[model samples]
Target: MTETVAEAVARRRQYIAGGTMSINRAIGPAKLFVRAKGAYIWDAEGNAYIDYHAGFAPYLFGHGDKDIDDAVIAAIGSGASLIGAGTMPWEAEIAEMLVEAVPGLEQIQLTSTGSEAVSYALRLARAATGRDTVVVMQGGYNGWSDYVSYNLMDPGDVVADHREGDEYPLRVTTAGIPKVIDTTVRVIEYNDLAAAERVLARGDVAALILEPVLQNVGVVKPLPGYLEGLRELCDRYGTVLIFDEVKTGFRHALGGYQAIAGVRPDLCTFGKAVANGYPMGVVGGRREIMALCNDPDPGRRVIIAGTYNGHPVNVAAARASLLRLKARERDVYSELERLGARMQAGIEAIFARRNYPTTFVRQGSAFALYFMDHAPRNWRDIALHNDNERDLAYRRAMIEAGVFHFPAATKQSSISLAHTDDDIDRTLALTEDVVRTLG
Candidate 1:
């Protein structure tokens, strides 16, 4: 007999420590997803969902994208799972494409996951600058590394003392991190140039890292001249500027958000949609800084190594994804913008008649619904004013109604290249129904 959803959930809980691989996966109602194709996912019990979550914004072209899948299948057929000894053609191909695309990426190295890429970037920065302390945004999520796992979605009270030029108390996201790690990190609110300068001016800081647009907390975009200001400050202070673009990379543009912003960082990290959901991460930037990974002097080398660092299958998928993005750049981005605009407009109209305070914030194909009157400027703004309960409740309702929005406050919902006008129409209708019953 096949196991039911309940049985599967129970069995998972019995074996898995938290019934999920990642703690973030614990959010929302559980479902046993049997299969997924294009813009839809099917549960084991025959229920289908118009998937807006898109595996945490990785599926830019949608699930089981033919171009990426075919490339992966071809790589598997080549019978070169892990040569482990020398360079692969796919690695060179993808690296060349990434360098050509991203503005700051003169050279790049791959990792199996974004978290690992971030770790390597930080290592390079520390070695290059000869400084141990690092600075990061208060609400930004830059992988699970101890150096960065701080102040992601802290409570209002924890950040109540925050001021424009002051750093927030470091609220470590996980417990197992060493107490000494906290000493090296300083957290500041997004969009505050004064705070960033104050922290970086200490002259002991190694690197200042951030998501250019602050995506981790529902798209708090940088204010005018913010990126440029940070660039100037980093140059003045001799600190390495790193853009943790894992969430904002290819999803926003082929060259990553740095290309769009036109303010290049010394180093940038990428993953997720770069491979169209394949497990691949990239760290690239100025050739001098990146070359530290294979420095001639043993003392100067910042080592970067992984068994599956440039696995052929993953490299193939990334190469295919970038080629398709480059070939159909106009059609692809325009369609994504169209679909995203339509969804945002529909949601705005739905809540216009009602007295609910809501803001539909979007950047390119990524979007979020915050139950607040105005767009949030930073995490403290969301924590102090946004209605967390209502946002989560609305998302939970949508999930039950077969429109899969991650049922958590401030988590982004994605629109894929495969999402059709009909998908948007159905999503709007479902949004209306959920909004009606939200009370």
Candidate 2:
């Protein structure tokens, strides 16, 4: 080991905000990673770990993918990334590919990050519908925007009652957000059709936004008829429907969960694995709504402008990655599901043997281990029922045992195409021992 982890944390704190960029802090000081490759990462101290964190689920093919890296390098060498200038030909090519892959996407607007993409989606909805209020799902993370920042998975007692008599107040997660911001956004429980109906029926909501599958706090799945109900409600109320797929976009499926659910949102935001960890985001949806941005009148149009809107290097990476996924969609997605199921069965076996009541929830490659016996429906249930202390201890044990699952409780762990049967077996063995030691 070159330096103590404490020393590394202290040094990082000197520059980085809160010693890290994400609010989901580790149980202990954050590990300083230096290098990575397929399915594994090396810490600054040169400790090798099988990486379940997987760069927050963006490394779909795993870190240091040759094709994606080569594409980025080639784009840079070709001088295509001249920054803040003419549109690259590959931009339209990538957009075309996305439209073909993702259902209900007729047009796409590019952005540098998912947060920015969601902001653009919201503004487009506001412009098209001529409404101001937004309805969001509890525990759904729509990035750090003021519009979607409220009701994020917080460390403490974060979930609050959405309705108090005649009024609903915003549950601000961060401090700097104004109290008035609450009035613009309404929070509803995911998978609760009645709550969604109650909120959307008001007809004031410009957009009803949520993750089709809640990934921010342990992949809470949408119950049957839940998403379809939202779609119907949004149509009835003249509101735009948005699916914030930053986490679930390309990781679970190239077409996303919407393709599987057979329910489409009017607008959808994509990022994370879209560029295989390259900085890129895409907001795509119906042509009727997205055309609002192209409105000729300068004052009435929705502005979808950004300096890095379609950076050639990032677009190249994304195009190559998506092409790879498209080329091997059957093999890639099937392998991920196979590996994920194997890991899920192994974890459940450990808990069953240990007599620990746990709920292991998964959809495709993303999974979570909750100490609660039942499947949690939303953030409130997760807060009241899931044992954070036990989950934190389990994650800490994984960290010490050469398995790098992220530290925060209820955060989903990912399986990548780079992860093979051998990796899952090794992780299962380590997890068994960790569960044994918890007594």
Candidate 3:
């Protein structure tokens, strides 16, 4: 007999810590999905919803994409899953593709997860600069590692004392992070050039890592000259600038957002859509920095070892995903923009007709709708103005109306390549109805 949702959730918690692998998944009502295809997922109870969450924004070409799956199948059929020895041909092929696609990346090493890649990036920066301190944006998230896991969505009170153009006190997201670790991580506000310079001026910072577009706080964009300003500051301070592009890498553009922003960092890390949801992470950037991973001087080498770093299947998937994006670069990105605009416009109209104040922000296929009237410039802007309860209510209502948006405030809604004009229309119609009831 098939287990019910409750039974399944219970079974999960019975063995897994916190009843789930990621505690964030435990938020909201218990939901157990049984299957997914292009544009949609079916819950165990057989309800279908157009998936805007896209499994946390990884399904660029869409869930179960045929070409990518075929590549994985081919790789598995070749009986070369894991050599556990010397490097293979698929590794070089994928690495070459990555180097060609990303604008600022000169050398790269693979890891099994984005968190691992981020960990390596931090290590490389510290090793290269011979400094222990790292500066991170207050609201930016760069994986779950201890080095960069502070101040993600902290409580308002925790950040209430924070002043504009200043840094927030260390608010670690989880416990078990060493207290000594707090001294090494410095927090600063996003889009604040003065505050960044103040922090970096201390002259002890090893790296300044951040997402080009702050997706962690619902797509807060960099103010004009903000990224360039940070670039200049890092150059002046001798700090290694690292852009964590795990979310905005392949989903926005093949070269990552750095390519579009025209500001290159000393290092960049990528995952998520890099393999279209396959487990792959990349840490790469300027050759001099990346060379630390295998430095001729043993003391300087930043060791990045994983038995499954470049698994053959995942490499095949990454190669296939990148090739498809490269081949249809024009068509794919244009279509994504069209769909994003359509979704944004329709939602804007629905809220406008309701006279409900809302702000819709988009960057290519990724977008967010905040209950605030104006676009937020930073996480504090969002924390002060955006309506958390209403935003969560709207997302829950939409989920019930057959549109899945991850039922969380300030989280982004993604649009996949498989999402069609009809899907957009249906979602809009559903949005109109959902908004009507929200009153």
Q: Clash pairs of candidate 3?
A: none
Q: Which wins on lDDT, candidate 1 or candidate 2?
A: 1
Give the per-residue lDDT of model 1 (tens digit) for 21-137.
887888657788889999999999899999989998899999999989999999899886888888866677778899999999999999989999999999999999999998988
Local accuracy by lDDT, each model: 0.90, 0.86, 0.90
Error of 1 at 239 (Å): 0.9
Candidate 2 error regions (>4 Å): 22-27, 154-168
* Residue-wise C-alpha lDDT for candidate 3, range 1-439, written one tens digit per residue: 9899889988898899988778767757788888999999999999999999988888998999999999999999999778778878787878889999998889999988889998989999999999999998887889889998898877777667788778887888888999999999999889889899999999999999999999977899999999999999999999999999999998888899998999999999999898988999999999998888778889998898999999988888998999999999989889999999999999888888766689999999999999999999888888888899999999999998999998889998889999999999999999999999988
TM-score of each: 0.98, 0.95, 0.98
Error of 2 at 358 (Å): 0.5
In candidate 1, position 70 carries an lDDT of 96
Query: What tens-digit string does per-residue lDDT give for candidate 2 at 1-439?
Result: 5678888888878998888777555447467788999999998787899998988889999999999999999998987864576666787789899999999799999898999999999999999888899988777889888988876664334444343212234568778888787779887778777887887778798999999999989879987788898899899999999999899988888898888889999999999899988999999899988888878977669888987788888899899999999999998999999999999999888888766679999999999989898988877778878888889988898888899888878889999888989999999998888778876
lDDT assessment of candidate 2? 0.86
C-alpha RMSD of each candidate structure in angstroms: 1.1, 2.0, 1.1
